[model samples]
Target: MSYPICHEEIIEDRDVTAQLDPRGDVAVLVPAAGAGVRLGPGRPKALRLLGGEPLLVHAVRRLAAAASVHTVVVAAPAADLVAVRELLAPVAPVTVVAGGVQRQASVAAALAAVPAGPEIVLVHDAARALTPPGLVESVAAAVRSGHDAVIPVLPVVDTIKEIGVGERVLGTVDRSALRAVQTPQGFRRGVLTTAHAAATDPLTDDAGLVEKLGVPVVCVPGSEHALKITRPFDLALAEHLLAMGR
Candidate 1:
């Protein structure tokens, strides 16, 4: 007969204080070069305030806090590199590199900067400042399990529809098969290098380029806490969330 296992029993069986994986020697790249054009006039997107600090700081801190991450590479503009270094230099094993106009370019720049390639390379947007610590651990664990690429995704809870340029409803989209992709996308170093090289131009996300390589990227459950701080309203909400320690 099968017996039920309690939480404490499971931990004891695993022979650990926590159920975290032993492999965490992952490299994390935080792309922070985008000029806040979409976010309005001045300042870069990474410098945008969220929860009383630059959004980039929060992103860096989260990755630095992860036991699985051995190094963090921040790609940003040369002009901002000095200031960013001053802000995050205390975070050990951190390096800042000049980025490019496109997201792919920035990633390439960061990749070039890493001396020793890690088993898993996680690419995350500095805009996603509030990513949960547990979520970060989950993606790293998934990659360590032999998956080439792992992305955190959220199932669409609201009914979705395809719309045209003129705001006309084009058609109803199948929400069942759709999930809104979130960041902290983990990839094997070799897999990402080949995929990024194959991609000649800018695409929406790294997964797009990876998908073109015919390798499927596995998705893990994500949380609302990992929301990307895109606009002014998002900044306000992030502050609220941070205050409540959510």
Candidate 2:
């Protein structure tokens, strides 16, 4: 329909900077396939109790409660899949599937399970039961804002050292540019898929795969509260932290 626009045309063109804001669906991937060798014979690392509940249960609940997250998926081990399914069935709508041998493979399996089309995906360690919801939200927000990937990291506070075999210190390492990375690591679905697809070797973290793709991964401040439970001492420390409400 052609309309008539006959009026005093005042064209005031100023640089209206529009902030790049992108929003789309999100999925949280929790790799629960590990046998918890460090934690000993158990359902999995995810099923280990951190404070009062299972570690995985806590992560799933937090993800479900997060405003930016839409779905939660667990790539679990064949031996522990049934237990994880039963334990987390009531907390949130989770899809439990068999995971692969390595962490990268597990994450890839989870990504494969994610529904097609563009989406924001977060790969978090289920062992990190106490990971703050804020961390998840922040990373997810960054991914939603058109970032290929986002990671939460903390500056290495302890004195760095380049140690060799048998606890021998090779030299003093620089801590200034070093950071200890943490999870709830978020990524755009396409980027994650491509990164995983191109991956040849097993990576310690998913972001390593992204780095191979040569994408600049955005980093956000991490929290001490979001510690990964690895050793017996770590478990004790987590208990202490929870008790102190830190």
Cα displacement (angstroms), candidate 2, residue 228, comes to: 0.4
Write model 2 residue lDDT over 10-110, tens digit each, in one string: 11222111221323367889998887788777656777787888878877887776666667889988777787889888998888989988898899888
- Indicate the residue-level lDDT of 124 in model 1: 93
User: Which residues of candidate 2, in runs, are more than 4 Å off?
Assistant: 1-24, 165-168, 244-246
Model 2 poorest ten-residue lDDT run: 2-11
Off by over 4 Å in 1: 1-18
Per-residue lDDT of model 1, residues 34-91, tens digit only: 9967677768999887766888888888777677778889998879888989988775
Pairing residues by index, what is the TM-score of model 2?
0.85
RMSD to truth, every model = 6.8, 11.9
Which candidate number maximizes lDDT?
1
TM-score of each: 0.89, 0.85
Superposition-based RMSD of candidate 2 using all C-alpha atoms, in angstroms: 11.9
Instruction: Please give the lDDT score at residue 244 for candidate 1.
Output: 87
